[model samples]
Target: MREFPQISYAFAYGSGVFPQTDGSASRPAMSPHPNPPEAILKWQKGGGKMIDFIFATKFTQHFHSLNLNRHRDHYSFLGSFGSSIISHVQDDWGAGAYFNPYITVNGTLIKYGVVNFKTLLRDLSDWDTLYLAGRLHKPVKILTEDPNIRVANQRNLLAAVRCSLLLLPPTFTERQLYTTIASLSYQGDPRMSLGSENPNKVTNIITHQIRNFRMLYHDLIMSLPNVDYGEARALQQGWMEDLKLDRPMAQDMDPAFRGNMVRRLPKSFRQKLYFLYQRKFGISGREFEGMLEASADEDAKGGLKKPVGGPFDRRVAAETDLREMVLKCVNQTVKWPSATQSLKSALTAGPSRTLRYLKEKREKGRENALCDGTIVALLGDEGNESMDSSENTTEDG
Candidate 1:
């Protein structure tokens, strides 16, 4: 195992930690191939994609200072500015992360990002910047663990589920649900628009890591009173199972339920949603905030306390534009941070390495576009009809 300085939390993700592929659902059993998976084998041999890591540290300056002393080559010209400046840039800059890409460790090319633990936790819980929070939405290989992050990430996952549900139709397939959930962070990401990322990135992630997604969300899905499965037994056994809406859309149509969903969203996101709500519907922000505060107070009481729906709840239920409002909120929340992070990466990774990374990404995007377009075209109108029929049936149910 590779050695590194002590850190609060660390994890590996990206194509290195988890290989990206399609058609996993239809993949043949290993017996026919009788060989180890190419991706896994390559990773084990340290010859595939560069392993990506994120390290969360208690003190940003101290950690960078130590890391700089140990691996001075990991940093670009920024090392000349001293650790204090590097730490300041990391904490105050885009998404509170500083990445050093194209570094070779133990003869294996690796890219690692450093972040302050406090920033990571806050973003996980409140989405102050969806940067790190977005990464945690997908599966990762944990190298080190912190209890606080584990708990905060649970809340993050729950918020993702609720957000996806609001944006989805009354009825959706398991694949569709996971796809939507996985696509949350990329909603307004500039990379997707600029062709710097795979057009089918979300689909690729869902197809490749469906089982991992299932493992992450299974227990949470089971606990939700509003959602039900067409095959509960199979679902409980960790198999792909159809989702049957318990009501119009997996939850009561009452404003209370939707309001509660909004209540539980990340703090920064919820605040943005509130702003959108007021802008579009002209609702009083004070009243909405008050209801949220009251609901939170009740929740803080811990024991069973019945929630009484207020005017804000009714307003949320009555608003025909709630879905659009949510979409706008998400887009706004993701847009700035994502753009800023890309710019910040240029400095941290240096111009030469940044150009190399962009070239690789663009090539990958081109390949993915060709593949994804064909797949979508093959699915054709049948997929749309199915979704339409499901929605109609759900509305009637």
Candidate 2:
């Protein structure tokens, strides 16, 4: 007889293999096997873990026979549904096979596990990078449940990187991968919880990578046949115009003034200015102020006077000061390296004035509408109807 590995443990094959058993010995076998004891002995001597649960035994056989290989590097064998083979083997079989429970390494199940693990690690990593990289809380659950479903760390990281690239176009690069990991590691450290230490290393890395990618792939990105460089240029020009306006306003006004102005300014104006400065000129707040002062001087010298017969009537000094500062900054920071006046004029011309006009017009219209509505409400319906009838008749005649 060939000596098989010693079975320190035994797994009873359930009804799936043979007959059902009641607790009592007198109970008839649902399906009796001629050599039940022999079969058990054979499995025992072969170093198999004793599977007591019938469901477990059936599942294990079914899964094992199916030999499902769902993912690249992982396979799943069913051995007792929801049963732990390692524990059973260790308890029943003396140090037999490695007794290790191995899940499919890169299949759906493993991917799910990896995703879950990544999420767990993310909270343990740098959260600022996650946020700045445009990753929110949703992917965490998906990743936690499946990491190995795709490629190993490669696919998981790539997917996250792609998402970051797509949502926040300004800060996506290959270098971000290493930087993000490093940042996570640093922030996750328990030592530097307070003080002057910057926790934004991950953000910095991401920024650097984006810069590098832009520089390296400039031609390729620009060369894409379907790409609309014209639209992009227009967008760039629009942003330049905005930065030209804001840099000065932000510079000339004190924080209190800025806060007040910000509150007073319409949302559209504020957003436009922010995008222009941030995207086009990349002018710092300090630089923006310097530009404002220069513009103010120019305006005082009668170089760029306020337009005649305009609501240039209200807060002329404040608005003039604001515009001058912004134009000055744009002139200084966004001028072509060749110092071309045409480029400067193009950036500072019609659009800026148009933006101001539209904003003022809208505000005035809103105020007028509110005042008219209040007056009408105070007047009786008869008066309101009379006013409407007169307007309608005037139009009809």
Q: List TM-score per model, in order.
A: 0.80, 0.16
Error of 1 at 34 (Å): 27
lDDT of each model, Cα atoms only?
0.69, 0.26
* Candidate no. 2 TM-score: 0.16
For residues 1-397, could you state the per-residue lDDT of candidate 1 as single tens digits?
A: 1244668887767766554663222321222112434433434342235667788999999988888888888888898898998998899977889999988654445788999999999999988767888888887766566778878888788788888877876676677778888888888899999999888878777766677676677667666666655544543442433223221224445666766776667877877776666666666767666755665523665763454445654576467877788888778878888899899999888889999999988977986522211101011243324323321001111
Q: What would the per-residue lDDT of candidate 2 be over residues 285-324, giving only the tens digit for each residue? A: 7765564443231366568443221111122223424444
Model 2: residues >4 Å from true position, as ranges? 1-113, 116-185, 190-208, 212-397
Q: Model 1 segments beyond 4 Å from truth?
A: 22-41, 44-47, 236-251, 284-310, 369-397
C-alpha lDDT (0 to 100) for residue 175 of candidate 1: 73
Tell me model 2's lDDT, rounded to 2 decimals: 0.26
Candidate 2 residue 356 C-alpha distance from true site, Å:
63
Clashing pairs in 1: none
- For candidate 1, give the lDDT of residue 32: 17
Give the clash total for candidate 2: 31
